[model samples]
Target chain A: MKRLREVFLSALMLENPLMRLMIGLCSALAISTRVESTLFMGMAATFVLVCSNTIISLSRKVIPDEVRIPVFIVVIASFVTIVDLVMRAYFPPIYARLGVWIPLIVVNCIILGRAEAFASKNDVLASVADGLGMGGGYTIVLLIMGTFRELVGTGKIVMFERTLVSLGSTFQPPTIVVLFPGAFFTFGFLMAILNKLENRWWGK
Target chain B: MMEAARTYLLLFFGAAIVYNILLIRFIGLCPFFGVSKSIETSIGMSVAVLFVMTVATSACWLLWGLVLQPLGVGEFLYIPSFILVIAALVQFEEMFIRKVSPPLYKAMGIYLPLITTNCAVLAVAVESVKPGFLKLNIPYHYSLPEAVVYAIGVACGFAVAIVMFAAIRERIELAPIAKSLRGAPIGFITAGLMSLAFMGFAGLFKL
Candidate 1:
C-alpha cells in the first residue's frame, strides 16, 4: 500500500508527464482553450493510459524485446480507437470539437512513455497506480490552463451552454488567452510556478 | 491548368504557413521542443519528417481509398490501422534506407524511429485522407497530387519552424534567465512569442 501511494504521488507531483517529464504537450495545448473540452480530453487520455498500462504490464514478459515498441503501440492504439468510437457516438459535439486530436492520442508519448519506462518493469497494481497519477497530473495541468484561458479569454466560464462564472461585461477579455500562443504562455507560467514551489519545498 | 496549379499552391501554403504543424496547429510539439535544442539535430529531424511524412501520408491515403473505405470499416478502423501503418512504415523505411544508401541513412537514421510517435506525421496522414479537420480553404477530399503537395508543405513548415526555433533557442541558452524557467518553461514562452508572430500570417494570400 505504501509503495503504491509513493508511485502515485510521484507521478502527480515529482515526475509529472507534462510539467517535469515533458512527454505529451501536443493535445494538451491544443484542446485546453475551454474547460469542458479539456475535461473530456483528460478523461479520454486517462482512460487510454490506465487501460494500456494494465495490459502492457500484464503482457510485459511475453512481448519480445525487439518488437516491444510496436506491440506497445498496437495496444495503445486499440484503446484510443475504443475511446474515439464511443465519444463519436455519444457526444457528437465534442467529437467534432476534438476532431483529429482524438485519433492523434494514439501517438501521445505519455501512454507510450509510461508503458516503456514504468509499466513493463512493474507489477499490474503499481502500473495502474502510476497511470492514475500521471493521468491526474496531466489533467490537473490541463484544467489549470483551461480555466485560466477560458476565464481571461472569454471573461467567464460556460459549461453545457450555461455560464458558470462571469466577470460581467465590465471585464474585457484578452482574446489571445484563448488562441494558440495563449496555450504556450499559460503552460510556461504554470510550469515556472511549479518549479518554484518544488524548489522552495525541497531546496533543490 | 493554371487554376489547378493555383489550387495546389493554396493547399500547400495553407498547411505549411497559415496552419503550421508545429507553432500554429500544435501538432508534433514533442519534437519541436525535444530536438530543437540544437540546430543540427533539428535539421536532421526536419529531413526525416519530410521524407517520412510524404511517404506515410501517401501510403495511408492508398490504404484508406483502396482497402478501408471499400470495406466500410474506415470510420472505426482508421485510428488503429493508420497508427499501425505509421509504425510499420517507420521500421521499414529505416531498413530500406540502410540497405539502399549508407550515407543517406547515416544522416536520417537516428530520427526515423522517433518519427513514428511524432503526432505531426500521423496527423498529416489522417488529415490527408479525412479532410475537413484542418478547415483549409481547399476542397473536401484530397487527390493524390494534392495530398503529396500538402504533406510536403507541412513538412517544410515543420522544418522552418523547428530550425528557426532552434536558432533562437541556441541564442536563448546564452541569455541570463531565471533558474526555474531556464529549460522547457522558457522554451514554451519563446514558442508562444513565435506563435504570436506566425499568427500574423493568418490571412495572407487569402487562401
Candidate 2:
C-alpha cells in the first residue's frame, strides 16, 4: 500500500513531469490556451500514457536491449494514432483545435522517458499507477493554465462552446493572455510559484 | 522559374523570423530552454537540429510518397513508419558523423539521440505530408525538393532563434537580476519579449 501510494503521489507532486522535470512543455504551453481543448488534450495524453506504459512494461523482457528505444517509440506512436483517430471520429471540433499536437504526442518526452526509465524496470501494475499519476499531474497543470489563460485572456470560462462563467462586461481582457508571450509569462510565473512552494515544503 | 525562386526566398525569411519553430510555433521548447544557456552548446544543438531535421523531413516525405503511397498503407502506418525512419536516420547520422568527423560527434554528444524525439523534427515530417498549416507558399502539393527546402528553412529558423537566444542569455548571465528570476524564469520572459518583437515582423510579406 505504501509503495503504491508513493509511486502514484511522486508523479503528481514530487516528481511532476512538467513542473519539476520540465520534459514536456511544448504541448502544455500550446494546447492550454482554452480549457475545453486542454481537457480533451489532457485526457488524450492520459489515455496514451496509460496504455503505452502498460504495454511497454508488459513487454519489457521480450524487447531487445539494443533496440528498446525504437520499440518504445513504435508502441507510443501506435497509441497516439489511436487517440488521433478516435478523437477525430468522435470529437471533430476538439480534434481540429488540437491538429498537429495530437500526433506530436508521439514525441512527448514524458512518455518515452518514463518508458525508458521506469516502465522498463517496473512491474505492469506499478507502471500503470505511474502513468496515471503523471497524467493526473499533467492534467492538473493544464487545467490551471487553461483557466488562467481563458479567464484573463477572454474574461470568461468556456467549455464545449458554452460559457461556464464570466468576469462580467466591465472586465478588460488582456490580449496577451491568449498569445505566445502570455504563455511564456504564465508558465514562468507558475514555475516560480512552484519553486517557492517546494522550497517551503522542504525547509530548504 | 521565377515563381519557385520567390517562394523559396519567402519561405527562408518567413520561417526564419516570422514563424520561427522555436519562438512562434513552440515546437522545440525543450532544447530552446535546455541548451540555450551557453552559445557554444546552443550552436552545437542548432547544427544537430539542422542536419537531423532536413534529413528526417526529406526521408519521411520520400517514404510517404514512394513506399507508403504505393503500398496503400500511408494512412494508419504513417505514425510508426515516420518514427522508424527518424530513429534510423538519427542512428545513421551518429555513425556517419563518427566515421567522418569524430570531433563534431563529440561536440554534439547526447543531443543527436535526443533529436529523434524532438517535436520540431517530427513536426517537419508530419507537416510535410499535411500541407495546410505550414503555409509553405507553394501552390499545390509539396514535391520532394519543396519539402527539403521547407525543412532547411525551418531548421535554419530554429538555428537562428536558438543561437540568438543563447547570445542574449549569455549577456543576461552578467546582468544582476532578481533572485527568483535569475535562471529559467528570466530566460522564458526574455523569450516572450523576443516573441513579441517577432510578432512585429508578421504580415511584412504577403506570401
Candidate 3:
C-alpha cells in the first residue's frame, strides 16, 4: 500500500510525464483542445497503457532483446487498432473527433516508454500500480487542459451529453484555442505555471 | 500537361509556406523540436527529411493506388502501408545519403532513423491522400503520379517550414534571453507565431 501510494504520488509530482519528464506532450497538446475529446482520448490511452504494460510485463522474459522494440510496437499498434475500431463502431461521434489521433496513439511515447521502463522490468502488480499511477497523472493533466482550452475556446466544456464544466457563458471563445498556435502556447504557458506551482509548494 | 505543371507548383509552394508541413499541420514535430536547436544539424536533418518525405509520399501513393485500394483494403491499409513505406524509405534514404554525402550522413547519424516515425512525413502521406489538406481536387479516380506530386509537395512544405524554423532558431540563440526562454520556450513562441501567421493563407487557394 505504501509502495502504491509512493508510485501514485511520484507520478503526480516528481515523475509527472507532462510536467517533469515531458514524455507525452504530443498527444497532450493535440487532444487538450476539447473536454469530450480529452476525456475519450484519456480513457483510450489509459486502457492501452494499462493493458499493454500488463501484457509486456507478463511476456518480458520470452522476448529476445533484438526483437523487443518491434514486438513492443506491434503490441501497441494492435491495442490502438482495437481502440480505434471499437470507438468507430460503438462511439462513432467521439471516434470522428479522434479519428487519426487514435492511430497516432501507437506513436505516443508514453505507452511505449512505460512498457520499456517500468513494465517490462517489473512484476505484474508493480506494473499495474505504475500504469494506474501514470494514467491518473496523465488524465488529470488532460482534464485540466481540457477544462481550460474548451472553456476558453468555446466558453463551455461539453463532454458528450454532459455539460459538466463551464467557465462562463459570456466569455467568447478565443479563436486561437481552436487553432495550432493555441496548442503550442497553452502547452508552454501551462508547463511554466505548473513548474511555478510545484516550486512554490515544494521548493529548493 | 499545363494544368498538371501548375497544380504541382501550387502544391509545392502551398505545402511549404501557406499550409506549412510543421507549424500549421502539426506533422513532423519529432524532428522540429528535437534538432531545431542547432542550425547545421537542423539543415542536415531537414534536407534528409525533404528527401525521405518526398520518396515516402511517392512510394505510398503508388502502393495505395496500385495495390491497396484495388484490393478492397482502403481503410485498413493506412497503418500497415505507412510502416512498410516508412521502413523502406528510411533504408533507401540511409543508403543514398551514405553514398552521396558521407559527412552530411555522419552528421545526421542517428537522427535519420528518427525520421522513420516523424509525424510530418507520415502526415504528408495522410494529408495528400485527402484532397482538402493538399488543397487540390484531384477527382475520385486520380492516378498514381498525381498522388506522388501531392505527397511530394506536402513534404516539401514540411521541408520549407523546418528549414525556415531552423534558420530562425539560429538567430534566436544569439539573442540574450532568460534561461527558461532559451530553448523550448522560444521554439514554442516561434511556432505559435508561425501558426498565427499561416492563418492568413487560409482560402488563399482553396481546394
> Candidate 1, residues B1-207: lDDT per residue as tens digits?
999999888888888899988988899998898878788878878887898899899999999999999999998888888888888888887887789878767765445687899999999889888865765744378888988999999999999999999999999999999999988899999999999999999979786
Give per-residue CA lDDT, model 3, range A11-68, as digits (tens).
6667877666766676777768888888888899889888888899899999999777
| Candidate 2 error regions (>4 Å) | B131-140
TM-score of 3: 0.86
Cα lDDT computed for each candidate against the true fold: 0.90, 0.86, 0.73
- Evaluated on CA atoms against the true complex, candidate 2 attains a DockQ of 0.74
lDDT of 1 at B180: 93
Q: Tell me the spans in candidate 1 whose CA falls farther than 4 Å from its real position.
A: B96-111, B137-139
Give the distance in Å from residue A96's predicted Cα in candidate 1 to where it truly belongs.
Answer: 0.7
Q: How do all models score by TM-score?
A: 0.96, 0.96, 0.86
State the lDDT of candidate 2 residue by residue for A92-177, as single tens digits. 88887788898899999899999999999999989999999999999999999999999999999989778999999999999898
Give the per-residue lDDT of model 3 (tens digit) for B98-161: 9999998888876797676666666666655633223433334335676566666666666666
Q: Report fnat in order of the candidates.
A: 0.87, 0.67, 0.26
